[model samples]
Structures are given as structure tokens and as C-alpha cells.
Target: MQISIIHEREVWDRFIDQSPGGTIFHKWDFLKTVEKHLGYKLLPYGFYVTDEILCAIPLFYKNIRGVKMLFSPPPQSGIPYLGFVLSRNCMNMKLSKKSQRMYEMGKVFSDEVDSLSPNYVSISLTPFITDVRPFKWNGFMIDPLYTFYFDLEQSLEDICNGFNTSKRTAVKKMDKYNMKLVESKDVKQFYNSSVDRYREQGLTFPIVSIAYLEELCQLYPCHIKVYSIMDADDNMVGGVLASEHRKVTMWIGSVKPSVKAPVNEFLFWEFIKKSKSEGYQELEMGGADVPRLCAFKSQFNPDMYVNYRIYKKDLIGSMAEWFYLNVHRKKKA
Candidate 1:
């Protein structure tokens, strides 16, 4: 197998569409947006056997002082997962054959990543790609992470049946207030609310520039939508940012309203119905890792899915990760 940096946007995007684990985050424009806003170099890698593609991954290459680093779906980007996605043919292989192909792909990719000589490396694989033994064998530490998912195959009534009593009540109370949900292009307002929410809880919102938010809306006008909750007086109180695909995702939810109302719950209820109405097979409501978030997300009674984050660090790389968590995070996104 040969691993090469693929620069063709159409090729990369098409491959991502063909792979089961791939999300919009792995697509050409999204990575380019991250590179533009985060100032990290985006490297799109395609693993091939002779003339056929096997799998592909996106890595963001960055340098801090003198240490080089490589990360897929880099930390604090609020990107849930972005590693490699195998071809449909590879995914459909018989068990033993698939496992062997995965091993080979992993070995070749791991060796190629090593050849890049990054002092630090990190990767987050989507839940659909569960084989991490190859990375483990290649000397990377593997840790489990989780995300919440709702299977939208069920009817809306059945889907809501899983919600706890309070969540159900919250969903019902939106009508009492005569509130309405309006899809808008006001990403700046959404970014401000998100920033304020994060700051209120002493956590920084990952993307600092509102331009980044604007650019995403510009790039994916149809795929990404922001729904704002408006009052009887037409005041925007709460909203949600979501991206549509085979599986829809709740990317950002506005803070709770200043006045007493079920803002978040109402937004989710409407969004879920919309996603289901649009015929998406699933809904990904990630970011339940934080205790408070986990508590709230649990009320929706979503099933848990496992993903893995693989990391390796030399001494300086280890120190860099430490400082990044302990110090740098306190100052900037």
C-alpha cells in the first residue's frame, strides 16, 4: 500500500461520501475551514493498493515552537471525530478478510504518519471504524470516548417516548409561550451566545472568530442550518446549529434563555422532528462527556456509541499536551 497526500478536493470529498464512517468534518471544505480559522495546515491522506483507494484520513499538521504535531479533528475544535474511513468494498469484506485488510491499512498508515516525524500525534476515529488494535500495536495509547445517538428510524412518537418526564414537559411547554422557530443566517448571534455560554461555565468556545462561523454557513448553505427560537414579540432567545447528512448532528445549542422557558429542549424537539422529517437515519447529539452535559443529554435517553482517541508523545510532546490543557486553554480557544 502507498500513502500519499491527496490535494484534489473532489477526489477526497467523493471518497468521504463513499465511506460509512465519514462525516462532513472529513470533507474537503470543512478541513479547509478549520485550517483557515485555526491556522493549522491540513493534510488529506489517501491509502491505496495499486490503483485502487482503500481508505483515507485527514491530519492537521502544526508546529509549536520547535515540536511538530499531527492531529485528526484536533482538540477543542468541537469536531467529534475525524480519522480514517474505509472504502465500501473494504467495509463489506468478510470478517477475517476485513480484519486483515484493516491491519494492513493501519500498518501502512501508521508507518507513513511516523515518516512524517511529528513529535506528537493524535487521532479520533468515528464509531463506525472500531478497529484500533493496529494503532495500539504501533505504540499509540488508545482511550475510549462516547457520544449520544438517537436512531431516527422510529416514529417521532416512539422517539419521544424515551425522553424523561421533565424533558417531555419542556417539549410540550413551548406552545404555551407562542414561541416559533425560524431558520436564519445569523451565525454571528449564534456564535456570541455560544461564547457567552462557554464563558459562563468557565470553558472557552473553541473557534474564536465569528468569521469561521460565517464561512461555514457560506460554504454549506444547505447542509448546515441555524434555527432560532423567537418569542411572541419576535425576540431571538435560543437556537441550535446543526449539520445534515446521512446522520444529522447537533453541533451547537444556544444558552438557556434569560426568562424561564424550555429553550434548549424546544430547539432539540423541533430539530429532531425536522431531521426525522427529512429522512435521516440517525441523529448524533455528541458532547455529553462533560458531567453537566451528560446529565442533560441523558434525559433524552439517547443510546451511547464508542469512539477512540489515539495518541503518542515524546517527552516534549507530552509536556506540550500538558501545558495545552493546563495553561494555554485558559487563555485562548
Candidate 2:
């Protein structure tokens, strides 16, 4: 197997759709969006055997203050996961062949990344990837992170039954308010609300900028939508700007509400029903790492998933990371 910098956009996006771990964030446009926003050049590395591509890594690279660093989605970009994606051909291979291929791809990917001689590297693989042993044997450390996935294949009522009593009651209470959940193009409002929500909580919003958010929606409007709840008076009470790829993801917009109600719960329940109606069978409920968030997310009884944050760093890189986490990030807060 050989590693090459892939140049075909259409082919790559199609490959992403066919992969089990792929999401809209893995699309070429999204990669460009991240590069444009984060100022990191993307290295679209693909692993191939002869002419057939088996897997690819959408890695981002940057040299900051003499330290070469690598990231998949880039930290604080609000992307939950973005790492290597296996092609459909690889994914469809028989168990024996697939197992061998996984190890080969892992080694090849690790060797190529190591060749870059990065001072620091961070890769957060999607939950569907399932195995990190290949990278584990290649001098990388894995930190287990988590996300929740609510199954949407069940009947709407049955899915609702998974919700706890309080969540169900909140949905019912919001229903009495006669609010309607409609898909809108008002992304500006949603992004501003998200930033305000973070400020209100004395924390920095994960998103880098509004331009990044707007560009992503503009590039794939069909894959993204602002599902807003509007009150009888035509006021946008609360909403969630979700993305529809293989799964309906509650991306952003579950923020501070203008009204005294469980707006987030209402949006989540409505989003699930709307997604189910649209024939999506899964919902990526985002990260479950925060204790405060886990409380609310667990109310829906979603299945748990673990994604690994794999990394390697030299002494200088470790110092930079320490300062970033302990000093810079805290200063921003």
C-alpha cells in the first residue's frame, strides 16, 4: 500500500458517504471550511494499493511558533470527530481481509504521519471506526471520549417512550405554547445565540467564527438546517441547527432561550420526530463528556459510543499543550 495526496473532490466526498464513519464534516468542502477558518493547510492523504484507494485521512497541519502540529478537526472547532475514513471497498471486505487491511492501513497512515515529523498531533476518530489498536501499536496514546446516538428506526411513539418523564412533560408543556418547529435559513440568529449562550455561561463558544458556520451551510444547504421553534407571536423562541447526513445531528442552536421553558428538550423531541419523518434512522446526539450535558442527554436514553482522541507530542509540544490548556484557554475563559 502507498500513501498519496488525493486531489479528486467528488470522488472523495462519495467515498465519505459510503464509509460507515463518514459525516458531512468529512466532506471536502468542510475540510476547506476548516482550513479557511482555522488557517491550517489540509493534507488530504489517501492510502492506496495500486489504483484502488482503501482509506484516507483528512489531516490538517500547521507550524506555530516553531512547533509543527497536526489535527483532524482542529480543537475548539466545534467538530466532535474527524479522522481517517475507510473506503466502501475496504468496509465491505470479508472479516479476514478487512482485519489485515485495517492493520496495514493503520501502519501506513502512522508511518506517513510520522514522516511529517510533527511536534504534536491530535486525532479524534468518529465512533463508527470501532478500533484503535492499529494506531495504538504505532506509538500513540488514546483518550476515550464519548457521544450518544438515539436510534430513530423505531416508531415515533416508541422512540418517545425512551424519554424520561420530565422530558416527556417538558415536550407536552412546550406543545401547549403552540410553538412550531420549522426549518429556516436564519443562521446568523442561531450563531449569535450560540455565542451569547456561551458568554452567559462564562465560557468560550467552540465555533471559530460565524463565517465558518455560514460557509458550511451555504456549501451544503440540503445537509444543514436551522430548525427553529417559533411562538404564536412569530418569535423564535428556541431552536437547534441540525445537520442531515447519514444521521440527523443536533449540531448547534440548543442555547439560551428567551422564554422560561425547556426549549432544548422541546427542540430535541421535535428534531427527532422531524428526522424520523424524513426517513433518517439514526441521530448523532453529539458529545456526552460534560457532566451537565450528560444529565440532559441521558434523558433520551440514547446508546453510548466511545471515540478515541489519539495523540503524540514531544517535550516542546507537551509544554505548548499544557500552556494552551492551563493558561491560554483559561485566560480566554
Candidate 3:
């Protein structure tokens, strides 16, 4: 096995499309947009056997306070998980053989990353790629994260029935408001609402820019949809921006603080119904680290999946972490 820089767009995206673990975050255009908007230097790598690509990982290099760091799907891009994308050929292999192959690929990937000699390295793997033992064995730290997923294969009634009573009640109450959900091209409104929500809580604004969202929406029209939840007066009270890649549709959205009409419940229910109608097999609600957010998302009765945040640090990386924990991160907290 050998590692090489993957420069060909068609080659990179074809593998991503065929990989079961690939999400929209792994797409070539998405990475290119992130690079153009966020100024992160792309350093995508691939593992190969002779002439065929076996696995690939997308990475972005950035200098933070003069400390060079590497990230996969980087911060503030609204991408939840993106690490390694393996070829579908691996899926048909025996379990033991597949594990061995993955272990080998992991080692190669680790070696390739180590060669860059960055101060810090961090990446979050997709939920489908559960084997992080190889990375751990290669001297990387691993942190487990969680995300919620709804099986859209079930009937709409069955999916609705799976929601907890609180969510059902909320939906019923939301119905009383006679809210209307309209698919809109208003990315600015969505961005402003999200920023307001963060500010109201004394939190930092999201890392990705409104321009990035707009470009992404335009780049993948069929894959991305922005819906506005309007009141009787046609005022935008809540909104959701959903992105679909293959069989999965993910919710990336926000709601107005003054609007207490359970717009989120209504918006999500509408999103789910639309996804089912469009033949999507799953709906991923993204991750909720905060207790309140988790509680609200859990009411939908979605299955829980674990994602891994793998990291490695050198001396400068250690100092960076110390500064983050003691100074930078504390200010945000």
C-alpha cells in the first residue's frame, strides 16, 4: 500500500459517491467552497494499492496564532463528520480481512499525516466508519460524539408515531398556529436568525459565512433546501436548511427567539414528510452536545449513532491546547 496526494476532482468525487461512508461533506465542490471561503489550504490524501484507490481522507491546513494545525472538514463549515472514505470493494470482503485492510489503511494514513509535521491534527469520522482502534493504536487521542438519525424507510404514519408524546403534542399545538412552510432562497434570513440565536446566548457566531451557505445552496440545488416557517401574517418565525446526499437528509437550521409557537417541531415534521416523499431513506438531525438541544432532538425518537473525534498533538499542539482550555475557550464558555 502507498499514500499519495489526490489532485484529480473526478477521481476523488467518484470514490466518494461510491463509498457508503461518504456524506455531502466529502464532496469535491464542498471542500473547494470551504477552501475558497474559509482560506484553509487543502491537503487531501488517498491510500492506494498499485493503481486503484482503496481509501481517501480530506484535510485542511491552517495556521492558528502561528501554530500550524490540520483538520478534516475543519471547524465552522457546518459539517458534522468527515474523516475517511473507503471504497465499496471493501464491503464485500470477509470481516477479518476488512478489518485488516482498514487497519493497514489507517496506518498508512497516520504515517502520511505525521509526515506533514503539523502542530496539531484533529478529525471527526463519519458514523458509518466505527473502527477508530487503528488511529488510537497509532498514538492519536479519540473522543466519542453522538448524532441522531431517523429511519425514513418506515411509513409516514409509523415515523410520526415513533415521536415521543411531547413532540406529538408540540406538533399538535403547532398546527393550531396555522403555520406555513415555504421553500425559499433566503439564505441571509436563515443566517441572521442563527447569528441572533447565538448572540442572545452570549455565544460566538458560527464559523461559516453567509456567503458560504449561499454558494453551497447554489452549487448543490437538488441536494440543499431552505424552508421558511411563516405565521399567519407571513412573517418568517422559523426556518430550516436541509441538505441531502444519497439516502440521508440532514437538518441544519435555526428559529426566531420571540416566536414561541413550536415552529421547530412543525418545520422538522414537514422536513421529514418531504424527505420521505422524495424517497430518502434516512434523516440525520445532526449532533446536539448541549443538554437542552439533545432533549429536544431526542423527542423525535431517532436512533443514536456515535462519531469519533480523533486527535494528535506535538509540543506546540500541547501548548495550543493549554491556551485553548485556559484562555481562548474559557472566554467563549
Candidate 4:
């Protein structure tokens, strides 16, 4: 087995879709797209078994003061929640007991980090496994992460029944609003409108940008879609921007606050129905922080899980560098 760095766009694109948790966003082109649109530097890591490619890691290198650190893509603008994405296949390959694969995979990644001259390495967004302690290195640590998942495999009857009676009643009341859900490829209009809504609520938009989303649309044409709820007046009231990679369809939703509307409920119901009709295995509503948002997501009866904020020595120093940039250097975020 060998590890290699890929700089070409096409090679990374082909490799990304083949990985177990592959998605277009993990492609090298996404890095270029983000660089062009949002100016973030993303490096790529490719693992190979003899001549066959096994897994890819989308990573970036950053220097904080005198210490060097490698991490997943950083938050664009003020948006938070950045994660290091790896193909689930990579995890499976790493954890396989048959060939002592997990140990080998860990060695390969850890060695690669050392070669890059980083003091420590970190991985985020990993599902909790019972035996990660066996995969540790001298300076590395694995921490459990929690994530919420809404099951789409169950019958709609089951999901609808699981909701609180009052929430279910609210969804039913949305029927009187005469809402229609439509799928669209127009990401710019949706992005702009959503940003405007966020600004009105004094919230920073958590999206990349129009150009970057356009690149993602081209990369995952069928998987990336905007589901919008239009009112009887032919205006979009509520909508969600979603990306389907592997079996997970994630939430990226916003609504017009001008009207006291049921758009959120209508949009979610439509999205759920669409997921069921399209045969998606699950719909990930994304993690929530606010109590109201958490409660709202809970209304859907998703399994509650927490995503960890793990840090290695070098990585935490990298964060300290960021703090210095803002505190001492006086850089605005």
C-alpha cells in the first residue's frame, strides 16, 4: 500500500466518487472552486493499495505562528462547523480485521502527517466506534463525535405517526396554505434570497457562494437540488438547499420571514415526501445549536447524537494562532 498527493482536478474527481462516502464536494475541483469563489486552500490526500486507490482525504495545511497544522477546510466568512470528510469506505478499509487493515491505514495516514512536518493531526466527524483505542499513535487521539440523523427508511406512516400530535397537527394545518414544492437548479437566486433572509435576522450566511454552489451543481447535478415551497400567490415562501452524497440528504433550509407563514413545515413535509419517493435511505437535518432549533429538529423525531470537537496538540495550537490573529494581530473575522 502507498499514499500519494494528487494535484490534478480530473484524477481527484474520479477518485472522489469511487470512495465509500464519496461526494463531488470531496473532489479536488471543489477545492479549486472554493479557491476561486471563497479563497480557501484545500489539499488532497489519496491512499492506495498497491495500484488500486483506496481512500481520499480532503485536507488543508495552515501555519499558525511557528507551528504548522493540517486541517479540513476552514469556515468561509463567519460560517462555522467545518469537518474533515473521508470516504466511509476508507474507515471500513482501515478497520478491517482480516488484513490488519485498520492498523495499516492508520500508519499510512499518521506517517503522511509526520512527513508533512506537522506536530499533530486531527480528524473530525467520525462515527463512534467501540475499538478506536487500538488505532492510536504516540501523539494522536481519537474522540467520539455525535451527529443527528432522520431515518428515511421507515414508511411515511411511521414517521408521521412518530411526530408529536401537536406538531403533526401543525403540518396538517399547512395543507390549508396551498403549498407546492418544486425542485430547481437555480442555486444563485436561492442563495441570494437565503442570504438576504439571514441578514435580516442578523445571522451570517453559512453557505459558500453562488459560484461555488454552481460548481457543486455541475459536479453533483442530480444529487444537489433546491426544494422550494410556493404559495398560492406564486411566490416562494420557504425552501431548502440540499445535497445528497451517499445515502444522506442534508438540510440547508431558509424561508421568507415577511409573512407569518407555515413555509418551514410545508417545506420539510415536501422534502420528506420527496425523499421517500426518490428512495433516499436517510435525510440528515444537520446539527442545531439553538434550543428552539434543536426542539424544532426534534419534532421530526430524529435520533439525537452529538458531534465532538476533537483536537490534537498541533491542531489546537493552530486554533491558538487564529486567536492570536484576532486578538493580537487584530484581524476581524
> What TM-score does structure 1 among the candidates reach?
0.95
Stretches > 4 Å off in candidate 2: 256-258
Output the TM-score of candidate 3: 0.94
lDDT of 2 by residue, 1-333 (tens): 899998989878878877786888899988988998999999988888998878888999999989899999797678888888888778788988988998888888888888999999999988768778888888889999998887888887887788899877776677577778888888888788777777778777788888888888899999977778888888887767688987888887576676786777877788787778889988887759988788878998888888899999999899989989899877776
Candidate 4, superposed: residue stretches over 4 Å from native:
7-11, 63-69, 77-99, 118-122, 126-138, 141-143, 255-258, 288-292, 304-310, 313-333
* Better TM-score candidate (2, 3): 2
Candidate 1, 103-186: lDDT as tens digits: 888788778878888989989889988889888887889989999888888888887888999998777676888888899888
Report model 4's TM-score to 2 decimal places: 0.79
What is the total number of backbone clashes in candidate 1?
A: 0
Q: Write the per-residue lDDT of candidate 4 for residues 1-333, one digit (tens) a residue.
A: 677777777877776665554544555655666656655356676777776666566666666556676665544421123333444455565335523654565678767777778643445543322334424643466665545666888888888888888768878788688878887777777787877887776565666567767776786677677766678987977677777666545546554446777677666677778777878877666555566567676776777556544346656575675675567433221
Sort every candidate by TM-score, greatest first: 1, 2, 3, 4
Candidate 3 lDDT, 262-289, residue by residue in tens: 8778877887887789888888886566
**CA shift of 230, model 1, Å:** 1.4
Q: What C-alpha lDDT, on a 0 to 100 scale, does residue 50 get in candidate 3? A: 87
Give every collision pair in model 4.
94-102, 146-306, 146-307
